[model samples]
Target: MRECLELAPDAIEVDQASVVQRLGSSRTNCENGLFQESFTAAQGFLAATARPRCVVQTVDLATFAGLYDGEGSNDRDTPLEVILERSEALALFVLTLGQTITDTIRRLFSEHDYLVAALLDGMASLVAESLVESLETRFGRHIAECDGKSTTPAVLAYSPGYCGWHVSGQRALFSVLKPNEIGVSLGAGCMMRPLKSVSGVLVAGEPEIHDFDPGYSCCSGCDTLECRARIARVTGPVCAKREVAWICSDG
Candidate 1:
């Protein structure tokens, strides 16, 4: 599983526009030369320092509840239950951009280069997204082959912190994923280390459940007011500063 889940750093593509928007400006308003320069530097750093890794395993949907160890109630609308209703199996996964990216951001914060650092923070998010995209593609192909289908099946990755699922559900996630196999570990607070890492389940049986189009913004489902995933609406210079602070504050 570990051998098949190693994600090469080059596999993830950093979205400069998304990172720039997170910095509080669009391409037109932001200085062309400065944005390009900073973006180039950040992209280079991400490509060079990011060590993308992942682990994936298939589990029977019937036993999905056992993975939680009787943690949550038998509520029909619970995230796991919702997933099980749509699929016969689940692909539990853990993915990360590795410690190098986190360490680089820490160093940048120490040096007071918050602008570039925050941009890197946003870029790291994209890198993780790209990793998941790649994983989903591969998962779809493999599942199709197993079922003797002409087209790949769909795969949707959902994390504990999103949807109605409380972030504490990560305890259950780690119980099944063993994230450390991919160089990821849960912090004392249940947040994954490396800051940019992500984990969750991928339901594989239904197209409507897992067939999300590429480029569907995760931001649409996220409402965290200060999330780095939130695109800046030209709020103000202070808003951008708050984003930087949020990233540095063990985000």
Candidate 2:
């Protein structure tokens, strides 16, 4: 049975304003009356500055194994009906999570404290990122294919805030990519259903990527746009990273 990727649990922590007591000084540009306006502006900037994509790879599998003796799933298949069912099921799950998280934000923070709330939510996103590592560790951490078919090697899996990727500018990044496929939808204010979700590409390259290889595969195996595939090789490396972001869908 193939094992599915899972993230580290300790990664699931939030950074509320109190979280900043040590990290740095807090800034509140989002004051009353202006809170909504400030938020809207930030959201707009995030959307515009967000790199259409950061990473250059993607992944798809028919089956995955659980971490524990029995957790998520084991065998895998990609029948058309099964794919649709899985997509809908997972999308619904995302939507349900989005709704629950949105409700929490509304109840927890003041209108002006939205930014702080986003930080805290990003902390929660760390859990999802574990999969990036888990996949890398369990499978082949880097590029394994030699002929032409394999997963991409994630050099950096950056999200908002890490490299200037902020939460506000990502309003429309996650709109309809797969709303029906994964129950992801944008609220009137542009918040994704699962307020804790994020968006960012995984920077990757082939095993031979060294020196200044601009022509190198920046996207690994995300699309047919990367290095050639390995010959007759089926096994591949794992890919994982934290999907944390209070609402980090900038790009």
Candidate 3:
């Protein structure tokens, strides 16, 4: 089944500390006037312009693998590939904080207001991610409910530009997800317009399935090994295991 979720702006809880950290500054160090001003401006922009929307469609492993293989330059052997192989279910999702935020960021940049622009951009990214996290949680709950299982599946999202997935992979993803329904468009190099948008596959299965050593060829060049943190989120007690029988339709 396919689901289109329209999220209220207030539903996205943006962590100010995380936004500050993304800006390469900590909350303690952000007491300076410039940082304070930029952050306040970013909050105002978010409140006034943010509109979060997400679309998700579930697909069987075979179909998901085809999309993965279609991305020509992608590393076939990687943790993401292994995780997908082990997944009981998969869903492709795309989300955006709407075009207004993107336009605001660009306008700020054009006006040489780089500080506020940076802060807003960072907050938008965090907001987009929070939407993804919410979707993951919802999908996990849906899986448990459908299966009448007591244990909720562990869900983790993997994007085209991350791990070993080639950025060009977004082309195949967009072809399926069709994020344009939510005013997001694919541009040159498979980059999504509304620059604050995010697209990826949510993998659901046993928590242990997501645990893997980051020793693949793709790991060498990675500066921020975010996979470790992502994996940690899902590692825990064993749960009932079953292959999801649901097949996602092309929406």
Candidate 4:
């Protein structure tokens, strides 16, 4: 949505369709019904705002994002193996996310349950934040493609709550990201719904200054091609919307 130069070289590969479908299905058939349509309106929001200032810029954050391991999802005092073995913790982990998202994709289509719809939409906005990171990777790739100079791929996604960043940092991140740059906006309830979802920045350069920790690399490592249209996306191809529009327009 941001009208700058072309994108940079993208790195991470994940099934965007699978993730969205999974999010939608998990929201619908799972314990709670969640509604996720941020991706659908991301472009529309950009179209509405039409300002290039909100687009996010690419930056190397190995130092900023992966600076400390003590701030990870793992407890500082606990060991990795112990944390993995704690079923209670794992259940809470899944359930917390589940509660955060009511029933995904259903309310977006039907709009019958207002409260559930709100919760689902809210969670979708949060998950949609990843799109911002993915775009950053592609933007990085675009920089390389257009510039014709080789560049390193993104090391990892650096969001708040990882390393020493408190989740509260979302405030600053939302503000600094400024959706208008890329055609997105944040809601009064801190929800970047519709299109202005928020994510953090991490550049690829000077590994000596910062590099992702091996222990938590899995979270950032993206070798899998999961997005439905990875190649086109990197080439600045936005995902097709016929099916998503059908879902939204259906009675």
Q: Which of the numbered candidates is closest to the native, going by highest lDDT? A: 3
- Candidate lDDT values, in order: 0.64, 0.32, 0.82, 0.34
TM-score for candidate 4, residues paired by index: 0.37
Q: TM-scores, in order shown? A: 0.77, 0.33, 0.90, 0.37
Superposed on all Cα atoms, model 2 deviates from the true structure by an RMSD in Å of 15.7
Error of 3 at 163 (Å): 1.1
Ranking by lDDT: 3, 1, 4, 2
Residue runs of model 3 more than 4 Å from their true location after superposition: 236-251
- Counting clashing residue pairs in each candidate, in order, gives 0, 45, 1, 38
lDDT of 1: 0.64
1-251: candidate 1 lDDT, tens digit per residue:
22335545555566666777766776786567766777777788888888776677877765555764336622234444544677745688887888999999899889998767877888988767656656666666668888788965545566676644567778887876677766788888788886888888766655554322222233355555332222121122332211100011111
- Name model 2 segments beyond 4 Å from true: 1-97, 110-122, 125-154, 158-179, 187-191, 206-251
Tens-digit lDDT string for candidate 2 (19-117): 334334444632355544644443333323222111112332222111111221212221211222222111101212233444444544666566645
The parts of candidate 1 lying over 4 Å away from their true place are 1-4, 68-70, 73-76, 210-251
Name the better of 2 and 4 by TM-score: 4
Worst 10 residues of 4 by lDDT: 87-96
